[model samples]
Target: MFHVFCLGFLCCSMVFGILLPVYESYKAVKTKDVRQYLRWMMYWIVFGLFMCAETFTDIFLGFWFPFYYEIKVAAVFWLLSPTTKGSSFLYRKFVHPAFEKREPEIDEMISQTKERGYNTIVNFGSRSVAYATQVILQTAVKCLKT
Candidate 1:
């Protein structure tokens, strides 16, 4: 039971960390919000962290057995579904959703970019392989040259 849950959790983490970011980048390009992809990726990281914490605690508390841990999974999933890193996990899930308050989704970001103009930007994906690999290769080559 735990194994299955763990598998699902692992998949979610991979999607949020990797697949989702790539998708966000595509979304940003399509929406003409060059920086919004990075922002969305940041939100994914925040959500992944929250899911890890909540699920970890529930598993730690020994509350994830017999009933298949639906409550814990649902609680964590719903909490992390929002697109914001502003609120803490618990508040964002158990509280924020109640008020129908949404974190900035990629669509909202694209809209903002359309309405206004791009001024401030964040590289949210500087650590991405495509971005980081060039520097890594350069450093390796420099060391070889030395």
Candidate 2:
């Protein structure tokens, strides 16, 4: 059973990591279509977030539920199928609504952070590093003296 699971895992890794990218790249290059690329990106982003949520759900429900894997497989099918619009429904019902409410505040924070400028960030980072180095040196010296 363990060997079979390992083999299936390896096969999935190869298909997703290697074959899928190659196929997507070929399609992108052959079509030379920006919309296709954007659609692909959108699908992957939605799928990634869905996977995260699914993982947490699995962690919580898996031990007690014998049919968890079947449910997850069905969910993957629902999410990937355009006819179902699962991804769009999730985005519209959850993500978009949340972000819409916070958009103004997020934009304000971004502008404020940008206004601080590059030099300010550089100086802050340098100061932090110097402080850390000083602390480490003092600790070493104290250890040696002891």
Candidate 3:
């Protein structure tokens, strides 16, 4: 019962908090606006209702719907949830160009990446991890010898 409620809570939060924002970001790219609206408010209401469904499902039916209830139902509730395509499209089309706003830093990073590549960063991080692990092992071995 409580488990069902908890799952429902997770679903609602995922839908509202994570999914909605991502969707809005996508819409912003497609529509070129980041303004909040009736859609967001409606989703908030839907999340509340879904939470209620989770809490009372057991009471009503001795069964759990548990928020993966149905795509049709969720779609009806969500009424065209935001998709990621718009966002990626927006990033390539709009954002990449706007990073001109960070000209010097972007140029420096690109130059370093062209010169040294990702392997340099990865090799440095890996070397640090390996050195730390060896130091820890050597310390343990010394303590045992003592």
For this target, which candidate reaches the highest TM-score against the unseen true structure?
A: 2
Ranking by TM-score: 2, 1, 3
lDDT of 3 at 107: 93
TM-score for all models, in order of appearance: 0.35, 0.52, 0.28
Q: Write the per-residue lDDT of candidate 3 for residues 1-146, one digit (tens) a residue.
A: 65665476468657654586657746756775544444444444444444466567647643444444343235333433455333334445654467667889989989988778777888899999999999999999999999
Off by over 4 Å in 1: 16-18, 29-42, 51-59, 62-146
The local distance difference test score of each candidate is 0.58, 0.67, 0.58
Misplaced by over 4 Å in model 3 are: 1-18, 21-35, 62-68, 71-146
Residue 48, model 1: lDDT of 62
The per-residue C-alpha lDDT of model 3 at residue 58 equals 40
Q: Write the per-residue lDDT of candidate 1 for residues 32-57, one digit (tens) a residue.
A: 88457555554555556665676666
User: By summed lDDT, which 10 consecutive residues of candidate 2 come out lowest?
Assistant: 1-10
Candidate 1 has what TM-score? Answer: 0.35
Give the C-alpha miss distance for residue 39 in model 2, angstroms: 2.9
